[model samples]
Target: SFHHYETPEDIRSKTMEWIEDFHADTERNATLWTMEKLSKHDGSDPENYPAHVCVMEFVVQVGADTRTFPSWKGHCVTRRNLVHFRGLSIDKNDIRWNEDGFRPLPDLACCLEKEKEYLLQNLETLLHRGGRIVARLKEHLEDQDQSRYTLP
Candidate 1:
């Protein structure tokens, strides 16, 4: 979406040209557009029905450059966790958004709460398993004669 600033036409054109040039080196098809047709909602669709994002991967060619991104998820970080903890491939600065800034999803609290409870519930088992493994390692180390080990 282009911003509707009440600026002169020439200025706007130059600004847009500059912006496009700045992003010219970036990969093509890096931006995802909303496609309503041949979507996931239909029963005949092989992909998940009523999917918000396209799970399918696609390639787009722009001049001599070729770029690829998933149907819906594309290169943008849409989730709350992704906004904060972008995976290895994503750069925070490159996140796509039409707004002045990005905001994490509003439902992140519930997800965080569930994650906290899950961690709490599994903490004991994890600790117990760690303790057993450490004890076994210590026992094995004790049984081995240190002098018999050779350094590389």
Candidate 2:
């Protein structure tokens, strides 16, 4: 249902653009606006339903332990069926549509979390601040062969 609104390539392009914009600006984080239809996929009156557009904000920051992390956090404020707008924090990872008595959409929350991870991977390449030590360690490990075969 969600793919009907935004394709995977669309998501990737938008995410990459955001990262690039943030890197160039260096003053403000990148903001992305995406809309996903909160439907049960019953295929009834899909066009008549209005989806609550979500606004997500992201920033790349280094932790105290010197690990790079993407601080991608935002809330989904959705107006249900032309009514008043209601919201749930994406940071919570458990979205409960209590206003309309709709059950929690774990998939939606999971998708949002996955976007954050994707942004982190993008940041690793853009910022190159994930940690030199870790990168070196990974390189060292990869350089060594782990084959269990014994040569004659």
Candidate 3:
């Protein structure tokens, strides 16, 4: 899970704490082991078949206070790309334990594209808001200068 903060420093501390807690949790101890295995098997040609299929999960939380401020704006982005098993050959392909061995699915590409689009839309909105705030601030500064200084 990702939690946003008004300042980057605050979020950095929280992120470190979360990492430490995750490492200490016994129930979640296997998370890093699984990730390492996945990394080693990813894109490996002629794989005998991974013992277990892995599904990566992500969570994000955007703080309310940081959402509106121009200077303190923050974003939480997650990207997931589908895994394709084009080279791996398997015998007796069957779904067990609610998990299927690595195999290419036609719909996976479409789903990934949709997710990418959603993230892009969110980033675009943030940029738009930042631009608007900057323009308003510039106008305010100009107005202040006009009122404070007379023609000399």
Candidate 4:
């Protein structure tokens, strides 16, 4: 599934192998993917609603169970060898709320890889938007500074 930028075939294949190995590990199932990272916020919108979809990953988890329901630990990476971003927190309690844990490695690997593909495809667009946001934020701060009275 080639997309906007061409990754060398060796890199792609090697990356998948590493992902599969990590997934199959009994002690660690580390995956990297992009999602509409969100956090519960008590903002003007709502007291306990997920915040907006920024390009940044909030270490948020999203999954579904094949038996009863599923759960996940989340991490995001945008490229072949680099971790995209790391957040301040994770679901620290190991929330497997389905009465039993049921995560098949192959399926989980596919799910993670798919999300990674989606992120890779849109990476350019997202980066442009982020740049625009930064420019706008700088302007906003400057405006606020001008409005404040300076002590002589």
For all candidates in order, the CA lDDT equals: 0.28, 0.29, 0.28, 0.27
Query: Over the stretch 1-152, how does candidate 3's per-residue lDDT look in tens digits?
Result: 33322335654465445545545665553333322232332222214422221222211122222243221111111111111122122223322121442212122233444443443334333333332111111111223323242111
Report backbone clashes per prediction: 1, 0, 0, 2
lDDT by residue for model 1 over 1-152, one digit each (tens)? 23322445664465445335434635432443332331332233324532222211111111112122332222222232223332334443332333433222222233344433332222222222221101111111232333332111
Off by over 4 Å in 1: 1-5, 27-102, 105-152
Please identify model 2 stretches exceeding 4 Å from their true place.
1-3, 6-15, 30-54, 58-152
Model 4's number of clashes is 2
Model 3 regions more than 4 Å off: 1-7, 31-152
TM-score comparison, 1 vs 4, better candidate? 4
Instruction: Provide TM-scores for the models.
Output: 0.17, 0.21, 0.21, 0.24
TM-score-based ranking, best first? 4, 2, 3, 1
Q: After superposition, how far is residue 36 of candidate 1 from its true place, in Å?
A: 36
Residue 33 shift from truth in candidate 2, angstroms: 16
TM-score for model 2? 0.21
Q: In model 4, where do residues sit more than 4 Å from their true spots? A: 1-3, 30-152
Q: Model 1: which residue pairs collide?
A: 54-72
